[model samples]
Target: MAGKEGKGAVKDSRINPFEDTVQRLRETFRTGRTRPAEFRAAQLRALGRFLQDNKQLLQEALAQDLKKSAFESDLSEIILCQNEVDLALRSLHSWMKDEPVARNLLTQLDSAFIRKEPFGLVLIIAPWNYPLNLTLVPLVGALAAGNCVMLKPSEISQGTEKVLTEVLPQYLDQSCFAVVQGGPKEAQQLLQHKFDYIFFTGSPRVGKIVMTAAAKHLTPVTLELGGKNPCYVDDNCDPQTVANRVAWFRYFNTGQTCVAPDYILCSPMMQEKLVPALQSTITRFYGEDPRSSPDLGRIISEKHFQRLRGLLSSGRVAIGGQSDESDRYIAPTVLVDVAETEPVMQEEIFGPILPIMNVRSLDEAVDFINRREKPLALYAFSRSQQVVNQVLDRTSSGSFGGNEGFMYMTLSSMPFGGVGLSGMGRYHGKFSFDTFSNHRGCLLSCSGLEKLNDIRYPPYSDWNKQLIRWVLGPKSCTLL
Candidate 1:
């Protein structure tokens, strides 16, 4: 079982293989088997067990696919996913209960609440960067919200894809969930079908295609796309402290992270000081020759390696700019004095390369950030709270980091998604459950309240109109 057929015992020819699977999932959803809180909790527990049982298998697959070390794999992918499963399991009962809402004067005697109902069948298309985390985290929400899910893992990450397709399905109820595998062609075929909901994580270009395909069936979608995230370094900060934080996140997973700081904004003087500090930090984290570092990950493929290697010429190399094509390795690199028109600055550099561009003041840094598409994550480093506040106040991003990196991801309380070009919608913990579930406004009234409702359905008269106005108007509160 290699390639797409690795999705359990299913086989893939030149034709569509998912037709039967999708229909079966929809049939399972119709049975209402997944709607119960106990069922959802049980599925979540099974997901947690899947993580615990296949920990070593997942780690090895990630290592094979991305050269991810055990520590990095655990921190970014496995642990976070496990925590999500645990959180959903702990909270599923409360999340499934109907929420009582405040009623107006006329409906005071009636029961009003929001019923969180599952969308029948869902499609989750995950990206390759954090394959397991991205795939399983969303799966937790879909399952917790009691929806049948069809998971499409990125085919580019072959090893992890294989593990997820073959091993993960054994944990969950096979009839209600599935792992569909393939490239763009397969995705296109999947998208052509009607689904209740679609959750996608990938590039903006492909996001547009997914959105377009979804428009045909009028299916709701959650597009977690990527953008060039900015990191602004204030002149008032300690160079070493800022460098260590920025470098650690910038090169994490060889900078394939969507939320990683893509570029640096600072004054010329600050840039000069920070460059040396960053050089020292990179050497410390990955060693003098990063190619020899077991902890450092390599680029995903030769195509991306060549693309990242091309960016090295965009600016003067202030730190590392080394590469080895045979090994698919690029050192944790930093480039300074980069022009705004350069390719590295223009695009999201999803590699270990970091570019630094000069801005005269905090105002300029804010202005520079605003001129571009809003990013998924934005960072402002300053010892002064006011400076950090000023940057936050002036700019918009999906998430903000003040004097830190992407540590906010660790907390399930915060949402993880983008705004504008970065992406749309959000997910994580309760938000994920909410995203998957439809909040239906519901009301139950007395069957014998016909006389009370007659005031709203009538031929016009001055007295009746006046009474209706009094009942529906803002002054109804005053009457109450």
Candidate 2:
């Protein structure tokens, strides 16, 4: 259950089947028919209709597997999908426009520009957590950039994957926008086939495998992986606001989110005050018996259920460690007296459980984080400008939120990704569009300028060198 079982004897499935699909899509890109605005618009419209028509099915499927509420599903999955389509609809014409740039020094006689071109066929391997949103978001980018996509949804979330496979092909073209359904075997097949680009979202362990596969073809990749996202609390911050923000974030998707606050590093003095506030805030959010609360969601599966349950046994539970397997519920739990070397502290908790580690001073807390791997997101609660600045300068995370939590990841305009072990690239809104598109440098020269080549035909002369320097040197004076 921890690692891939079959290594030597069994053929690696993550490479070969994924490759076959890409081979088919590559043929479509080779046809030269993908360059038209009409073709791009048609695909976007088809995708939009596909998502809208099957919105209810997707919402229900997510709820069945992950207990994701309808509002959460629609807001995170459907609205974002519609928004991407809207952006693509309004901007595809302009995004496809040829941009001209200023010519410099030696190239003054030539016109220079950059053309944003498609990366031919692309393969997007999405994660099970936030299955619909992760899958569709990348698909939007691929279509917006005018590239064919072969989407492979995680089999762990089988219900949602079945829904996507059943519904997506009804509206979109298989050759341009196809969904392949399978487990590790199918993913391996797809990765083996040469693709211009590969976008993968999952854990760092699997991300390494994807990167290794991509390296075989020298295909560029954008990996969105997880890290131990941390939270810091300064003494000056409002206890109520801090508690409310942390509770809401910890409960989101039962804390299965990649950007959720995994643990907190706070002052020893603020620990007692912060704990009560968080307990109160959690009660207010879900009331008593959070298992029965519709607003409060359940853990995604039994495996995750046992994993979080084991964390409770590792340390003293400070607040809320209730669980019911039949309900698939684990109350939002917080741990105190947690050792720095504890198993939960060593890796991303990725559950409703949160660990609070206390230090003597703010500097100590910052140093503790600095010593660990960089996280995907960092949150610090403080009203003091100096405290905020110090934390921001001291540690590195993919994104930052001060006195807030998890909201930054939702901002479509902001780029979302990790650094070091967290992730390799960012993709959202225009960033997403750029991730799937290749910007090519272009230069143009008039036929009449052919005589200018004489200056470079025999460039060994001192006179020519001086003449070239005169024309290419930086200007320091204003012309009359």
Candidate 3:
């Protein structure tokens, strides 16, 4: 009996490590050491150094995990994170300032403002695809907003995860930040703890679980989830250009990106032109054999590789449908005559596969998109601006890109997020800072203004009532 009790005690200790880390971070937050703007700036600078010093290490890890090229790693992960860090460092002061608001006659003499205060402790659960960018971008905002954070990076990306766990802590202040590593079990345990703010980036199925856990504590959440993003290419556009843009985004990161074009909707005539154009673009970009090209990335894991290999049978392969199991490589593939009811069409094809389905006209394409769950992004390629505007006016998505792909993500000024089933809440630049903060509505009145505030006191008369109404009424300038 004593032996069994001792074994149970040892088991409990193993599970308590994450709980202990969260408690420690909460204690650090109570100390108010992370609240100062200077401390936040120093942390941001350290993060920048972490990126700069370990650039090669990150590149190699990314390559090992996803076969990502040096250029792709820099552009998609390291550079994007570095840009976020730079933007936060430059704008931290302005973002941290209390915003002054207008007052009515009742409080014209008082100071009215919205104070952005940190939410104490924050939890960020990032996905495997674009792991560093997705994780660090939110981390920059949480830290800049002066919140102690706990980051849960995806365990699937083992190589990148190792670098983050092993090296990232050496750069930042350990007391105010921590990295907890594990699979779903660790995530489930972490969610049981109370965090002031929770930010998650993953699939909607897992997103629901995160929200359910957060609801237990009434914790605010920013869910950056994914969906089947649709791309509509009008017949009026140049087929080659449309194909280039679509192919680039669809196959970027081996199509593991949340915002990548999941499928294509176009007319029968346009589909014919697009197939050849896409074939040309794929060959041009990846050479005659994509598997031999050093630029193209391989699938992240054997499980995903097998899943993609199974999807090849869904439709008639028009461009590329080759796979190598040993290397976990799926050639840049495109399919036509794909039925809407097929498995490839029903789910997000997060692989190097693009399925083009025929739509009679723009109205049909719009109807098809509207009938499904709102996506993280919607794309339309057309030479006519009116056609683009028509699609934009008729649909709702987290973001709309006409004659482009996911290039809008490069601009930090725009808020990046999803709607409805895709996800909730916005982030990037100032949006991220705001998302991690509590906008406390505050007003300060003079201590000696009691006499002025007596208009509606116990001795309220008709004249005093009229005066109060007049003071509270809307201003003529406001009406104008």
Candidate 4:
């Protein structure tokens, strides 16, 4: 299910409960409590400990909320967050160091660099899908950057939300970290207060709402609003190999991932071949009855389950298309003969459903992908190196995968983010630290350089202007 940014209707006109929490954190931030690199490292280490200690509790919470399997939880959520934390810890000191900037002859004797400093009292609004990962991943970045943070985990994922609100804070310093829990109305109310920086993850429709709210406070935001990511299958590839990789990632976490291949773009002949291969792969991966498989997870909520159930009508059910509302389980489904105007085509199918839309050639597939809003991730499956290169060169996306899935997400060196409607800003690894920190350009000149700096003083003359111009000009640093 895609993350929801609820309308946040405040019916009773109740007071915002987050005022004290905000003020308290602001006070702590003002006191310079979170500024030291050592303090930041300690918080990050403690966060790692939180995950290691509560692995079982977290798994159980995920199971309660999404029926997420233990292995999937560890692979997708826990391990990924841990990797981010460890990476930040290992690189913290260097990341905090000021980066030296080249100097002109006018300021050649001055020390100039960009100091990365924290944006105090930030807010991280995480999504329900991959709750622990989404919530803590940014939390790790915020802490590493020395920012006191307030977390708003999706209320829909009550199990993980409970842990974040109750257990996670105990691991870190409460003065510098906090968790506030509520539904749409409460979140909207919380958004009313000003934050130094805001990080949001969810759908674009709600991204606008968050952006609008941030505008009032002039807060910088990193919005990870995911879209309907496309997966293009080349006619040159082996069907089974593509099917195994595609099916595994698409159905992983019951297709609740934002980066999962939302639909397939391929030729009619390829579609015909892929259907059977996908069917075989699905069976091999999850037993015939996917609902009984512990490896598979359930939809997050009744509303999302019904929405996905309705989307199954968009095309011919080429494979599994069963739904059990009682269990919030929708069978891993694939659709064929689907139209572009169908409901499934228009929206991000953040569920266990994949649709194949027929295209005549590679050119047509590229055009089809380009016509839509840029997605957070795009996948191309091909055996030929030229074909993968063509897709990468021609299309625009936040991230790309060739002959594979979202494995790029595992690499700390690579940035994970969206472009255009998918979302804004890059984060993950060093990018995360950079996103949370303010790069302040600084210069320190010697007090004894007053006589040497007199050429730039207000006493203007032809000789002084000529000297200042040449000293500050492009040729000053050039070789004679």
TM-score of each: 0.97, 0.93, 0.96, 0.95
Per-residue lDDT of model 3, residues 1-480, tens digit only: 001221211123454646666777899999999999999999999999999999999999999888899999999999989999999999999999999987777787888899999999999999888878998999999999999988888899988888887778778887888877788987898899999999999999999999999999999999999899999999999999998899999989988999999999999999989999999999999899889988888888888889989999998998889999999989999998999999899888889999999999999999999999999999999999999999999999999899999999998899999999999999999999999999999999889968888885878899999887777778611210
1-480 in candidate 1: lDDT tens per residue? 222343334445557667778888899999999999989988999999999999999999999999999999999999999999989988888888999987667887888899999999999999998999999999999999999999999998989998888888888888788888789988999898899999999999999999999999999999999899999999999999999999999999999999999999999999889989998998898888888888899999899999999999998998888899999999898998899999999899999999999999998999899999999999999999999999999999999999899999999999989999889999999999999999998989889968887767778688888887777677665232
Number of the candidate with higher TM-score, 3 or 4: 3
How many angstroms is residue 397 displaced in model 1 relative to the true structure, after the best TM-score fit?
Answer: 0.5
| Model 3 ranges off by over 4 Å | 1-12, 476-480
What is the per-residue lDDT of model 4 for residues 1-480, given as tens digits with 9 covering 90 to 100?
A: 111222121123357567767888899999998999999999999999999999999999999999988998999899999999999999999999999987888778889899999999999999999999999998989999999998889999999988877777777887777777777777788889999999999989989999999999999999998999999999999999999999999999889999999999999999989999999999998988888998999999999999999999998999999998898889999999999999999999999999999999889999999999999999999999899999999999999999999999899899999999999998999999999999999989888957887787787999999887787777776321
Worst 10 residues of 4 by lDDT: 1-10
What is the C-alpha RMSD, rounded to one decimal, of candidate 4?
Answer: 4.2
lDDT for model 2 comes to 0.82
Report, for all candidates in order, the number of backbone clashes: 0, 14, 0, 0
Worst 10 contiguous positions by lDDT, candidate 3 = 1-10
Candidate with maximal TM-score: 1
Question: Candidates' lDDT values, in order?
Answer: 0.91, 0.82, 0.89, 0.90
Candidate 1 deviant stretches above 4 angstroms: 1-15, 475-480
